[model samples]
Target chain A: MEVVKKYSETELVQLLQQRSGNVFSYLYDNYSGALYSVILNVVNEEELANDVLQEVFVKIWKQIDSYDSSKGRLFTWMLNIARNASIDMVRSKGFQNSRQNRELSEDVYSAGGTSETKTDQIGLRKVVYSLKEEYRVLVELSYFQGYTQDEIAKMLNIPLGTVKTRLRTALIQLREIIKP
Target chain B: MDIKAYIESGVIESYVLGMAESQEAAELEQLSRQYPEIKQAIDEFEAALEKQSLAAAIAPPAGVKEALFSSLESEFKKDRSQGQVASINWGRYLAAASVILLVVSSALNIYFYNQFKSTSTAYQSLLAEKNTLIAENQNTQTKVLDLYNSMQMMSDPTVIKISMTGIAGKENNLATVFWDSKSKDVYLLPNKLPDAGANKQYQLWAIVDGKPVDAGVMGTCAGLCKMKNIPNASMFAITLEKKGGSATPTMDQMYVAGKVG
Candidate 1:
């Protein structure tokens, strides 16, 4: 049971900029769970998700110097990296060829089921599952699946304007549901 | 710009969720700086998303972390090796330098420890000497204060100074008694008296109407020694008696006597 030292956001960024390995370890220990969940949701396979998570951290370490605090928060930046890496793995030629038979909807359903079983400890699966079907689908596509608003609009056969508003409404609803 | 309309347009949400086009995101970033409300809206959404993501976290398989760290370490090693061809030579030089440094530091440690030990010993002795000097100073101050008080008492108009000269064969023995008639307090100064040997003490006696009343025994003091108070005494005298003082004065051993003038 090693004691983990806590750092404020500013201090963490400063240490990270100084290229401290210990701060990187702290970052991984604290945020890896959430990053893994997002990665798993996108890749939908444990082995591939693991590889994506590793790649995401490596990218985070390498790109830390370029991180702009004014643009967004550290967690948000890392989340973006994780989501991008997971999406890249899923859209790769080998991954799509292997799972070509499975429908994208079935992939989403299986991803949801996998997340439900894996994240039972936190019980946040219920929160996402509890969303209205339309809002939940929009959130899963735009957020977890890393689909562009335009792509989601085309895929769901909805107007681009409708996709944008519904995605916003879904997030607002999520904010309300999770508000303390 | 209509800030409320811009907010309701869902641009801030799209920006936070990373779904906005690059052009749209760039525009939002610029506008957020100009408008605080837009910034607040973006921040609120980002916080909400972060909280939800955290609540939805799943621990990765155990060996993943170990494998990831080892790979990172190996990558670091590969980079170092690739960058430095003469690293082996540098490693040998570093090892030799560190060995010398260790020996030098150990020697310095022993030297410093010895120096500290002797310094502390000297400091302790000096501290003890200072305490002894302080005690001696206090003793001297007390003697000086006693002398000053005695001088003050003698200068008072109501105090009569009685000089008791040695009686008969003990003529060299002399003492003085300062008697304050207003307060009837008696103080004695054994000016030139022989030390009373073991098992004996010098005692003072005050005579009232020709009857000698025992005063008190006199202890050796550097300054005036206070004796028993006598309201009316015609004479004061000192005599050598038993260590605790006799009830009646030994008229034969009367060393000094003086009439109160």
Candidate 2:
């Protein structure tokens, strides 16, 4: 069992800015699992998610100086990076072509129960999946896939006002379910 | 303004999710600063999102962490090498420019001498001035080359940089030691130290198994001075000593000391 050291947010940020390798290791240990899950959620392919995860960490290391604590927590900032990188990987031309082909052969791949079952095994992922179908899809698209409410509205053929309301409701419900 | 309504409007949620437009996000950030309750609401939502994300957490494959660290290490090395390349290019450019200037000046000297034999004294002064400029440029080039070499040595991956800071009374004194583990070579940079004057000099010591071994005596140098190598050592210290140096370190005269990691 490894004894993990704890640092306050301010201390962590200071050490990170100083390029302390120890702090970076501590950061990776504490947050990689959460960040990896976020990337996996967006990309949906384990191999691609692994690549995006590495890219996200590299981005975080390079751009840590740009991180502003006043805007949000460190993890929230990292979560956004993870999601955006994953989304970028999925949105690339090559990825889209491959994904289209994969979808065509989805029946064969589904038999293996890869990404869906893996996500379902997690406790909170199940809770998130249990959201009302409308709310769940909205949460998945906007939160995991880095889509805006307007974009979600356009994509889902719903009104912009309705998108905002549904997303708000969906998040509020998630908050309620996950509240300890 | 209705802060409660603003908080309840889910704008904070939008911002946390990174779904908010730039203008909306900026406004919320400003509002969060102004209102404690709005900040609290944003914090609560961010906490919820963090919890949700963590709940879905999956440990990456076993070798990923090692891969990430190695990539980072290589990235750093790449950056350093790029910097060295840039500096080397600049040095070559400067040298080329100086050589061009020297050649052009020599051509002018010959052209002026051939055009006016009666103005021979003026030509002699011009020749002297050109020679002085050439010498100055050569001196500068030598200094630049030395500085570049010192930088290259200091930035070597095998070199462990140790900053030895001043002891209690000599708090302003500072120096650095770059010890190459593979070659067992030591280089010292005297960053700040009181002048030892004529009779006394600074001596470096490497502590091995609780005893001090003399590394070398300091020479007055602007750049890194090569010191004697110690195959095994735990700490390094510098002390004021007799000009030629002493077999034993003068403990009370210790200026700066730093422990090896």
Candidate 3:
């Protein structure tokens, strides 16, 4: 029998609540790749990204019982968790070294598909690198490190308000640079 | 309201990216409610960053998923209900407990070793007593040899000899009081005196026809005490005195009375 893929997150969560392994297996098979994609973006190491992927799923399993439907969708929550885990790795000394070279993979979609949206990749990389060195670190901490602005401020030992200001400044600079 | 400038700042984008400090985070959260457009812009920024980073995705290690699931499954089951996790590895707990036990036993072993050390202290004290007695015996032998030589010298016809015997009131205490009148040297061999107690000393007295004269103080002895010097007296007696000795004996407390003739 052909299995129907789930589109509604609520049904997926209900299936998870019933403690069904098939639903979990399907969930892993489907979202694992996307989660790994998020992990790789921040950790930049295939092995570490994979490790984070496992952690992300495990965390979901442990904390799933506590999920409330009122707190938005599972996708949003998962994204936050995945993003946070990925960023955590980037902040670590081990993953920090993985940030060098091959800006935007240079030759990325020449192989992945025919869309040739590589220009967008180039623009994003240029926008990020265009940020001042301090702003770049702040951006990396916020975006790639998955740290909240307060976390960024504390990690950098700066004022909480300054983190917000720098983030505002950096995003404004990026918007100007990548106006296209 | 400078609302247009605030919206233009792209702080909304940073807030959506989870990059805002608390002040900014709070401002952005409030603004996300104020302007749905700001929220929409944040979503767009999030999507772009996601796509950009997704290109760098790497495959994780094999079986890591299994390990994570196992831990999560245990944690979830134990949390949702009350039963202990049977599937949890016993080796980890056992290893930790064993390490703690080893530390405690090591400390206990040190405590016992110190206890054994105090028991040896008594053995050290007994060994000290044996050494003291050995030295005392050697000194006494030398004194006896000197007394024999003195007797040989006093046998000369020129040396005077006197015999001192205890009086009736002190029959149990007597001394062979020898004297050389010309040399003024004497030896008092005292026996039958009670043993001394802590801090009390014995004194000797010389009597010339019932008048007591001073003889040097004598050392303590339960058996025999030998004292030197005789002051041409007809009698020798023993008395107890203070530690150093009194200038004169306590006549009423005299333990032994003797006459030397």
lDDT string, candidate 1, B1-261, tens digits: 999888777677677757778999999999999999988877777777777777677888877788777777754554434436467778888999999999999999999999999999999999999999999999999999999999999899999999999999999989999999898999999999997999999999999999999878998765999999999999999999999999998889999999999
Which of the predicted structures, 2 or 3, would earn the higher lDDT when compared with the native? Answer: 2
* Candidate with the larger TM-score of 1 and 2: 1
Clashes by residue pair, model 2: none
Off by over 4 Å in 2: A1-5, A101-117, A120-125, B74-261
TM-score of each: 0.54, 0.53, 0.39
**Mind giving the per-residue lDDT tens digits that candidate 3 earns over B152-207?**
75576655545444556766665555566776675555645666566767777777
By DockQ, the candidates rank as: 2, 1, 3
Write one digit per residue (lDDT tens) for candidate 2, span A90-158. 779998887665542242223245555565545344566868878877777776656777877887789
Worst 10 residues of 2 chain B by lDDT: B74-83
Model 2, range B176-260, lDDT digits (tens) per residue?
9999999999999999989998899999999999999999999866489889988989999999999989999989999999999
Off by over 4 Å in 1: A1-5, A108-126, B74-261
Checking candidate 1 for backbone clashes, the offending pairs are none
**Tens-digit per-residue lDDT, A1-180, candidate 3:** 122456466877886776655566666766665566556555555667677888798777657777765433455566667878876765667654554433332322123343323322332333565577778677655666465666667777899888777777888887655443
Tell me the DockQ of each model, to 2 decimals.
0.22, 0.24, 0.15
The true-versus-predicted C-alpha distance at residue B222 of model 1, in Å, is 94
Error (Å) of candidate 3 at residue A148 is 7.4
